[model samples]
Target: MPSKKIVKTSNAKKSQKQTKRDLKKRNKKITIKKDNFLKEKFLSSTANLLIKAVSIAANAAIVNREVGKRLNRRGKEALTIVSQLAVDVRNDVKQGVRAAKKIQAKKNGLKNSSKTRVRRLSA
Candidate 1:
């Protein structure tokens, strides 16, 4: 006798649909959280950098060549961080657009592959 595997075939598709729906909803929340995280990260970095610059200025050593070089390096690093953040956000938006288009295509149906013409308005 051969052992048979049990499978819930009908609910399999339904569960997949439910998972996609849940994923869509969860994605929105996750995006907001990501934005918040990036915002907080950038703001904190900017604040700390500002404080460091202010301290350097208060010490009246801003005129020193070494101090100027340090500030320049810090500024360049900050710019690099911000640029990378922008790239990440832009990539996320592009991914979202691609997902939206895929979903739209699925919703439009596979009538092109069907032998029979799909009736419009169910007339």
Candidate 2:
């Protein structure tokens, strides 16, 4: 009689488990890399947005400062003009009062002289 062959049976369940573990490990690595990339992208975008906002704010501040300076200059000019007009009006009023007083004095002197001359002629 021939000698019987001793055969070892491969364990199918154990092989399946190892393959599943390897697939899970590869998926985990891919997921970690993807998460890292997304985080980096988000950080970069946020930094860019912050930079733009700061620049815009700085520009606005400069513009506002310039506008304020212009308004200040205009306010000063308006004040000067108004003060000059007030001074001119005061001078005009003073001159008019002086002229009126001179005219009234002359008219009173002329009336008294005419009455005296008429009384002398009649006497």
Candidate 3:
């Protein structure tokens, strides 16, 4: 006895072609969805980067302004201290001049009378 061979029919061929068409359509839909998702992700990331850059610039400007204010305050404080020192030195010089004139009058043998003369000269 001989074994009989199985053969593919027209109905099987038609079903295979239908399955291939279905698979192709499903792949196309998945690819389109993936592309849309990637586009959205890229746009969101770019927007975030722009916002961060603006924030950094604003922070830098604030820091620069603060530094300028600090420098100005320090400069004013230094000016005030120097001006006060100058006034103190001027007072000290005036007092020394008065003391030296009094010593000179006493050495000239004019103690009581020198008082009236010194006062007149100072005025």
Candidate 4:
């Protein structure tokens, strides 16, 4: 008769369970690392966007201020020109009134004598 050898299968079953637990732990670690990487990427992108938005706002403010300054300068120049024109018109109107008065006096036969004219010219 030949002797028979018996093998226990309990050890094989235990090893398979340990391998499954190891795989689960590895999966958890991978998921945690992925979450951290995603968070970092999102934060960096938002920071860059904020910086760009602030820069654009500052540029717009500068442009608006410059435009306002130019408008004010033009307005002042226009006002000066209008004031000068008004003064010239007023002087012309005064000269016309003086000429009309002189014509009316002449038509009424109120002429100055030659002696008075010579005196006026000398004065």
Candidate 5:
């Protein structure tokens, strides 16, 4: 009597190929997830800032136009209030830009504090 061993070559090859494909798929999924997460965050933050800016500007304009017309004696006060609101909106826009720049720098593998400080100083 003789003992014989059998090796399943086709099965082994199939498994190897499947593992490689699975690895590639996993890496692709991770990259896509990271990209989508970053995109979503950027859009959400940008949308919030835009909404805030529009709201502030609309409020300031409405108050200046409506309140100024009714309170004839306080035209100067209304103008001053509108001016202040404009400044506030400007500051809000600047803050949004700063935040975006910081995120960009970080993504580029730059030191956030030093890069941000330099950028701000130059501005």
Candidate 6:
């Protein structure tokens, strides 16, 4: 009687297939986790950017309003100064004209007196 040894090859093949399935499952789970993490990060970052943009815009608007108010006040002050200068110039011109008229009248009186003396001497 000869004793024969039987090798179980099917069991080895089954184990290999099981290991391959497990590896595929682990890789799928890892990819899914990475994708979810990326999505969450992107969404949070975008939300933060939007919030910052809105805040900056609000601050800019407030600054613009303040600057506009200041410019308006300064413009009014400048306009007042210009108007006052114009009035001053008009007053100065009037005074100059009056002085010139007085001087001309004196000159005319002197000429008239001289002419009367000349006529008296000739007569």
Give the per-residue lDDT of model 6 (tens digit) for 1-123.
797888768988999999999999999999999999999999999999999999999999999999999999999999999999999999999999998998888898888888999999999
**Candidate 2 C-alpha lDDT tens digits along 35-74:** 9999999999999999999999999999999999999999
What does candidate 1's lDDT look like per residue over 3-122, in tens digits? 898876788899999999999999999999999999999999999999999998877764586778988999999999999999999999999999999988876656553423544434
> What's the lDDT for residue 119 in model 1?
45
Sort all candidates by lDDT, best to worst: 6, 2, 5, 3, 4, 1
Question: Which of candidates 3 and 5 is the stronger one according to TM-score?
Answer: 3
**TM-score of predicted structure 6:** 0.72
Give the TM-score of each candidate.
0.39, 0.68, 0.52, 0.62, 0.44, 0.72
Summed over model 6, clashes come to 0
Residue range 1-123, candidate 3, lDDT tens digits = 798887767988999999999999999999998999999999999999999999999999999899989999999999999999999999999999999988897777676678779989999
Worst 10 residues of 3 by lDDT: 105-114
- Model 4, 6-108: lDDT tens per residue? 8767988989999999999999998998998899999999999999999999999999999999999999999999999999999999999999988987865
Model 1 regions more than 4 Å off: 1-63, 110-123
- Write down the RMSD of all candidates, one decimal each: 48.4, 5.7, 8.4, 9.0, 37.4, 4.5
lDDT of each: 0.87, 0.95, 0.91, 0.90, 0.92, 0.95
| Residue pairs with backbone atoms closer than 3 Å in model 2 (clashes) | none
Give lDDT tens digits, candidate 5, residues 1-123.
697788768988999999999999999999999999999999999999999999999999999988878787577788999999999999999999999998887777666677888999999
Candidate 3 error regions (>4 Å): 1-12, 90-123
Clash count per candidate: 0, 0, 0, 0, 0, 0
Compare the candidates by TM-score and give the number of the best one.
6
What TM-score does structure 4 among the candidates reach? 0.62
